[model samples]
Target: MTVEVFALGGYGEAGGRNMTAVRVDEEIVIFDCGMSLDKILIFEKDFQKATTRELRKVNAIPDDSPLKPHRSKVVAAVLSHGHLDHIGAASKILFRYQCNIFGTDFTVELVKSDLKGEERYRSETEDIKISMYAVEPGDEVQISSKLRLEFIPISHSIPGTVLPVLHTPYGAIVYACDFKFDDHQLLGYKPDYKRLKELGKEGVLLLIPESLRVKEEMKTPSEAVAREMVKDTLQFAEEESEGIIVTTFSSHIERIQTIADTAERLGRNVMLVGRSMGKYARIAEELGLLNLPPGSRVYDKPETVARGLHRANKEKEDWLLIVTGHQGEPGAVLPRIADDELPYKLTENDSIVFSSSTIPSPLNKAQMYSLDTKLRMKGVKMFKDVHVSGHAGREDHRLLLRMLQPEYILPAHGDADMLSAYAEFASQEGYEINKDVFVTFEGTKVTIPL
Candidate 1:
């Protein structure tokens, strides 16, 4: 038996995230097709100059020359999770390929929401039509006569993230992407160690793992810490303040639920802002996973949010404002608020809670600092670091290495330094670097023979 793998998207490259195409005999499976916001910004500013057509090409999958002939024989396009860096470009890549797309319920919902938004941005031919198969943890999806796919639940920041196991003719290949072993997760469930152990017993020939947190020496913090941070911040905030603003990742539905519950407990009316946040919330609500309070509102238009904020401030001291722009993206709601672009002005006593960690990208750090400084100048009370990461750190990666014990290890989903760190850790464990352990780059293919 022979197996081939391609780093179609993500690799040593820091940003434009893509990965994992496996070809075994007649079956071809694509793992992920995600984009890098940092790369997109660069492409816009330098390459495309904000041209939509050029931006689409920059964001799209490379020419089908890599997988074209095998398109008819493709079995599935399996997604690891809901994060844009993992599944965001699916609509662009899979539009031409005919295959069943597989993900968890929440992941599918998120994709649907994104597809709806993409319709407005993309050409009619480039528009997405998602043919999805929703599989929960422990459920196996048969791709072809010789291959079966299983979803093993893993604890990440988002719900329904999984470690995929592909049973091929030679042996099982485990694709673990964007996950951490957070035993103290607040929503959904924990990583299924028992299932992982069972898969290990069955034999894992190759393990493709994410190296997002390889530079961090310790285990990633649990979501519980983030929850407590939110609780404490709200508990200590001035109760007499007329408006309360909380900004975080829009796709973090569990965190959104937590914030909503906190608002309810504080007797505050909830208003969700930003187009992306409102879109995801609507999809989450439609899926029955998120049924916010009857009075909870979502506003995509800035004028509507401004009016609502004004009325809420005048009407009540307790009003919860959930918004976007946690990373201080220019023109996003939070940055606009700080820049006084919003119709309503931020008052001295008002609170702005940043329930997110600034991604270490230089652009993000600079923008966040600028936004924070401006907010401080306004005398706005600020709460920061009310969040936790979803990626596994060095300790978690070590634990996974011990548990899986595959013949080969491929470090993925990070920049050169982070991937090098992960490779170094594997070397310390006596794994052969670039032999039994391989470090790959985007567009490179590795073939394993049995």
Candidate 2:
């Protein structure tokens, strides 16, 4: 008997996408049906207009062609988190496969929201149904008798991210990516070190960890640090002036919570400024993952936000604006405000804080620079990079290797440089390259030795 692993997507680069699969005998279990953004933005900005075949060609969506030979054996597809790179292509490609989709409650809601929104726009396409099941962390997910799966609680930028451990005859194949070992978290439980140690004792054949920040020498900072930073920035801004706007990733529920608390303490009424920010916050609150301050206002509709902005002008310090588009996406609230499409006014003495770092990309850099120029012309003061990454850095990576102590290691979620660095690091840590450590490219399969 042989258990095989497929590096369908996300193995070559970061931002989580495509498909990763495992095969045991005849049954197949897939993890992360994700999408990439480069080709989509470069070729076709509109997804509904682009055919799935074209999407596959541009690498916008994971090509499941590799799995077609064994498609009938596909038992299930589970998402590790709710990031777009992990779940964006689901509505586009999930219907092609017959298996059901599995995720945590928050992740399930995010996927359902995507499907529901896409259904409204895809009338020309054939009708398809998506089957989804919500599974919590610590739940045993049995795909087939040969491949048993379990969700180990983990922390990341978003809520509900987990480590997937697959049980087989040889040992367990632990899929650990897009995660951090955060014992001090604000919105979610700490990483389940207890369960991870248990997996170590049980024996792990191979370990796949996110290698995005493996070269960084420091461990990722705690969410609590960002919270304090938010509090300090808002307090300082309030003392100088009352008109302050904060932008961050919409999926970061913990960051949103910190913003809400800071606003409450400053006696400023919190007002959500974008549709996505509102939608994600509502989902988190509905799932009992967040508790927005009571009487906080949300203006998801453009017209409603315009009116709210007009009202906030009456006493700018009395209103705290939490918006989407920290990266300065054109459609985001900040860009619209800068472009004068929104009724909001950004004047001198107003504070604009970015609680996110500019993801390294030429497109992002250009867009952020444009936004920064516009705000600068208005003489607005800006604070940026007020946040920390959610990925595990070098120290944490070393700690994880020590904890799991797998016989083999696989590096993922990074580009060639990052992956190469990981291979060398793994070698230094004792795994021999090509033998114990595999720098797997997409479509490469690793067969467990019999």
Candidate 3:
């Protein structure tokens, strides 16, 4: 049997447009069709209204032309998690493949929600109907005669993240994209170390792991530590702050819960404001993944958000405002508020806490700088980087390598420097460059001998 791996996108980029495909004897399975947020921001294009051609032209979405010839051999597309960097381009690209989509429960729900916004776009073309299945962690499904897929629970910033393993005739191929060894996560499932050891013992032919943060010297801190940081930050805001506004990733339900629960303890009502805040939090609550305190509310509609902000302005001490735009993206809640487009006004006595780290990209850096300048001009107290990362760091990656001793290693989910760094680390672990440890770019394919 011949086993080949395709790096369609996200090979030389950091958390942007992640897509990979594996082929075993003419049958193929694709993983992660994501989009680049930096490209979207730099081009200022509406993601929903942008056509596939336009997105590809701007380098926003994965250019799948490399797979056009083998599209017929594709049997399934599997999503790792609900993050946009992992599953954002589903509505725009997955229609080209004649296959079912598979993801964990929350990941599937988030995708279905995103598809609703593409109703008009879908109607403009041939029927863009696709089947999606929700599988729980530890569940295995037969994809074809020679391929079986399994979902191994893993911890990350978002819920429903997993390490997808494809069992083939040669050996098992593990896709370890965007995960951390988080044991004390406040909300999501913990990493299944036992299962990973089992896979390592069973013999893994190839291991594809995310390279982001692999250069950091220490293990990534647990979400529970972040919970403490948030709690301490918000608790200190209770005495003197008139308005407390915390901004973070809308998809980070655990951080949201931490902020909400802390606000409740401070005798404040939680007000989640933003289109994405409502979309992710509401679904998480409905699915029993989040338990928001009673009397806490989500405001996404223009009218409702205006009313909510107006109310907060009147009684700023009574509300804890959770907003989007942690990366300072234009039109998101926190950025709009900094620009005075929202109803609530910032004051010298107010505090704005950022529970998210700035995503390391040029567009994001400039936008965040502008937003911080605006907020600083208003004299609001700003708190930054009050959180931890969700990707495995150097030591964590070392642990993963020790656990899964695969014959071949492909470092992904990072830029050129980061991938090279991972390759160097692998070399320290006795793997050779361009041989056992392969560094690939987007649109390139690596063939592993069976």
Candidate 4:
């Protein structure tokens, strides 16, 4: 048997837009069709109305043209999580192959929601419908006679994230993108250590792991730690400020829950604002993954958001506003607030807490600098990086390497420097660069024989 890997996107960049195609003999499977948020922000195009070609022109989505010849061989599209960077391009792509889509429950629901929005915007002549299956952890799906897929539960910034395993005649290929080995997450499954060790014993032929934080030289902190950070920051800000506004990844339901609960403890009601923020939070609440406190409100529509902001403005000390645009993307809720385009106004000593870090992309860095400058000029108190990361660090990578002793390694999901860092770290672990440890970029294909 022979195996070939096509790094469609996200192999050479830090911020997402990740797509990869794996072929086991004649059959193939794809993983994580994500989008580049930095590109999307820079272009400021409405994704629902934008065509696939337009998105490709701006590098917002992965260029899947490399799969043209092998399109017929593609059997399935598996999503690791529901993050837009992981599943954002679902409607833009996934129609050509018309293959079955597989993800965990939350991921599947999020994709369905995206497809519904796409359908609303498209003409009747367009056909965007595709079959999607929600698979749970430990469920193994036989894609074809030659290929099988398995889901192993893991923790991340978002809920329902998994390590997708592709089993073939050669061995199992483990996709370990965007995962943290944390056991103290309050709202998600703990890492399935026993199963990972078993997979190690069963023999992993190739391991494709995310290399974003491999250079940190420490284990990633648990979500529980982030909870404490949020609680501590909110409690301190409550005593010093009259208004509190917080921003984070909308998909990070755990962090949102922490913030909401902390706000309640501080005698402030929670008001979740913005479209994406309300969408992800409501979905998680519907799926029983999140139980929002009673009387807490989510405002997505423009009219509702205006009304909510007006109420918060009247009683600034009594309400805590959770919003989008933690990266300072233009037109997002927080930035609009800074620009005075919204009903609410920022004043001296008002708390603006960022429960997220800058994404480390050039566009993100610049936008954040501008946002910080604007907030500081308004004399607001800003609490930055009041959060921990969801990605694994150097020590966590070491533990994963020891648990799943794969014969081959492909460092993915980062820029050139990040990928090279992973390769160097692997060398210290006794793997040879250019031998078993491979570093590849977008559109590059590598083949291995078994």
**TM-scores for every candidate against the unseen true structure:** 0.92, 0.95, 0.98, 0.98
Best by lDDT: 3
- In candidate 2, what are the lDDT values of residues 1-450, reduced to their tens digit? 867788888777666465778887788878788888555556645675566788888787877788888888988888888888888888888777888888889999998887777776676557686789898899887777777888999989899988888888788988887788787786665788888888898999888788888999888888878888888888888888758999999889999989989999988889988988888988999999989898788888777878877888777878889987788788779988888888778889799999999877677888899999999999888989889899899988988888899988878777777888899999999989888888888778887664
**Model 4 Cα lDDT, one tens digit per residue, 23-130:** 988888999999988888877668988888899999999999999999899999999998888888977898768799999999999988888788767777876558
What do the candidate models score in CA lDDT, each in turn?
Answer: 0.78, 0.83, 0.91, 0.91
Off by over 4 Å in 3: none
Better of 2 and 3 by TM-score: 3
Pairs that clash in candidate 1: 9-18, 10-18
Question: Which scores better on lDDT, 1 or 3?
Answer: 3
The predicted structure with the larger TM-score, 2 or 4, is 4
Number of backbone collisions per candidate, in order?
2, 1, 0, 0
- Model 1, residue 347: C-alpha shift (Å): 2.7
